[model samples]
Target: MHQNNLSDLHRFIDRPTSTWSGRNDGAGAAHRRVHQAVTSLGQGAPDSADAVFIGFASDEGVRRNGGRQGAADGPAALRSALGQLALAQGRNSLRHTDLALLDAGDVVVSSDLEEGQKKLAAAVRASVDAGVLPVVLGGGHEVAFGTYTGVADSRTRKTAGSATSQQPGRLGILNLDAHFDVRRAEQPTSGTPFYQALTRERAADTSCRYTVLGISEANNTQELFDTAHELGADYVVDEDCGVLNQQALLSTVREFVASVDIIYLTLDLDVLPASIAPGVSAPAGYGVPLEIINVVLKEVAASGKLAAFDVAELNPSFDSDGRTAQTAARLIHTVLTYYTPLSSAAPSLR
Candidate 1:
C-alpha cells in the first residue's frame, strides 16, 4: 500500500512510470488502446473497478521445481504487450460501457515463496471483496494456489452467517495447461498449486471442482493421473483438444462451467505447442492449438460464472520475438471483452 513511494510499492522494482503506453489514433476514446483506459490502484481512486491487474513477480516456485527461472519478469512483459492492443470497441467491451480498469502492480517474492503466496492472497481478496475481477499475471503456476485461496476466502466471508451458510457455493477451477499440476510435493512448487488448492478446500469442507484442459499425456505420469482421479478431478488430454475435436472440447468446457457456481480460469502457456509458446517452464512437445484454446476461453467468459482469471508460465527468456507475451495478452484481452460479471449475471457472491 505504498501509494506515495513508487519504488517501495511491492518490495521489488516499482512499476514503471508508463509500462502501458501505446499508439494514439487521435480519433477520441473509442480509438484509444488499453493503456489509455487503465488507472493505477491506490491513487485516491474509486474503491471499485471492472477488473484489476495484480502481478505475482516470483520465481521461487519454478526454482524449487527445477525449471527455468525468468518467469519472475513475466508480469511486466505482459503489461507491455497488453498496453499496445486496442480495447475491444463493440457494445460488449468493458470500456465501451464505462467500466474501469486498474493496475495494482506486483507482489514481489524475493525468497520466501509461502510468504509471497500469503501476500498475493490478501491483494486478491481485497479486489474480489470489492466486486472487481482480479486478473493476475503470474511468476509460475504456483500463482494458482494464492489466487484460489483469495477467492475461496472471499466466498467464505460472504457466506458467513447468511442463509446459505450451510452451503458455500461450489468453486470450479478450469485450468488450461499442459500438466495436471497436482503433484504431491514436500513444499509448494510450480507443479503443486492445484494439489494445494484441492486439499485446502477439502479441509474446510467446501465445494470445489478441479478440471484441466490441454493436459499432455507425455508430460504427466500415471501416478499423477491416479491422483487426479482419486481427488475427484476431471481433465481432457491434449490430444482430445485438437482442431478436429473442437466441438467436443468446447462442450466439455461448457459442461464444466454449467456444473459449477463460479469459475476461476487459469491459463498456463505451456498448454500450447512449444513453437507457439516457447516461453514456459516446460514447453509442450505436442500441445493444443491456440484457436481451440481461444474458443474455449470465449465460452468460459460468456458463461457468466468467471470470478477470477490468471495467466501462468510466460518465461520471456525463452520467448521468441515476444510471441508468448503477445499471445497471453490476447487471451486476457478476450476474457475482458466478453466476461459477464457475476454481480450482473447471478447472485453476486463474487
Candidate 2:
C-alpha cells in the first residue's frame, strides 16, 4: 500500500498536449485554458487549491459486463476537451482569477479491478483531507463505488476526527444515468456501482439516500425496477425529465436537494440524446437536453451540498467529432464555475 501510494497515478500519456498560448488568445480562448491552467500534483504540488482532478484509467469493468469499451481513456479525453473550454468570466466581467486547479493525473486501474478501486478510495480520502474538492474522472461507472467509498471514508473521518469517524454526516447520491446500475454482480462492473454503494452504506450503518434521473423504461428490466423500489430509490424516467414534464422533475429534484447534507453527483454521458452525445457506449434514443442537464447541475451546485463529483462512461472509441467529450467537458465546466463551497473565501484560481 505504501509503494502504491507513492506512485503518481497516470497510466499513459499519448503525448504532452500543447499549452501554447496565442497572441489572439483572448480571456475566453480555450487553447490558453484548463490544461495549462491546472497545475500537476507532485512533491511541491499546492496543497490548497479549489479542486483536484483524479482520473481512473480502466475499462475492465465495462469489458467484464460485455459493454463497449474505451471509457478507460475518459479522463485524458476530458482534459483535452476541457483544455479548449473558455475560462468563464465572473460577475465583474473579468476572468475569475481566484480559482486554483490541479491535475492529480490518472489512478491506474490494473488487471485486478478491485485493487485499483481500493487505491482510488485511498487517493480520494487523501485529497479530501487536504481540503480540495475532488473531481474524479471515470474509467467506467464502476468508478462510482470507489468514489463513494472515498467520500464516505473522508466524511466519516471529518466528522468523527478518526479513521472510524462516526461523525453524523449523511450522503445524497444523485445519478444522471439511463439505467439503475443496480445489477447484483458477484464481481463489480459498470452496471453494479450504485448497488455496491447501497451495500456499503448498509454495512457501515450509515445513511445512503439515492435518486436517479433520466431512467429509460426499455433499457432497465423489471427486476432492476423492483430492486430500485425495494431500496426506496427515487427516480424520474427519461420522458419525465424532458420538455413536457419539466415542472415535475424540478419539483422532485428540489425536494431531493433539500433533503441531503452532502451530495455525490455522477453523470453518465449516455443520458443525453445520441444526437448531442453520440460518443458514449449506450447512446440515448430519446434523451434529455443539454440545457436541462445544465440546469439541474447548476442547481445542485448552487445548493452548496455537492461534496464530490464524477463523470462516467465516456467511450471515446465511438465518439463522433468529439461531441461527447465536449459535452462532458461542458458539464464539468459548469460545475467548476457554478459551485461555491459552503464556506470558502474566494473563487478558485491559479
lDDT of each: 0.80, 0.75
Candidate 1 Cα outliers beyond 4 Å, as residue runs: 1-19, 46-48, 90-99, 156-165, 346-350
**Candidate that scores best on lDDT:** 1
TM-score of 1: 0.89
Candidate 2 residue lDDT tens string, 1-350 = 00123233333322222232323365444435565457676533554577778888888888888888888888878888876766646566423435567777777675778887887887776665555667888788888888888888874334632336554566889999998999988899989988888887888787778999999998999999999997778898988887667667777877997677677889988899999998886788988878878878877765666777899989888885998998999899888777766433333221
Tens digits of per-residue lDDT, candidate 1, 1-350, equal 10121222243323423446888887666686888768875453444467878898888999999999999989989999988888656643332234467788888887789988887887777766666778999889889898888888875334532374577778999999989888998999999999899988889888889999988889899999999998898999899988999988777876897887778899999999988888888999899999998878877876767778999999998886999999999988887766677645522212
lDDT of 1 at 14: 35
Clashing residue pairs for model 2 = 9-106, 98-348, 98-349, 99-348, 99-349, 100-348, 100-349
lDDT, candidate 2, at 220: 93
In candidate 1, residue 215 scores what lDDT?
86
Q: Best by TM-score, which number? A: 1
Off by over 4 Å in 2: 1-32, 90-97, 156-167, 342-350
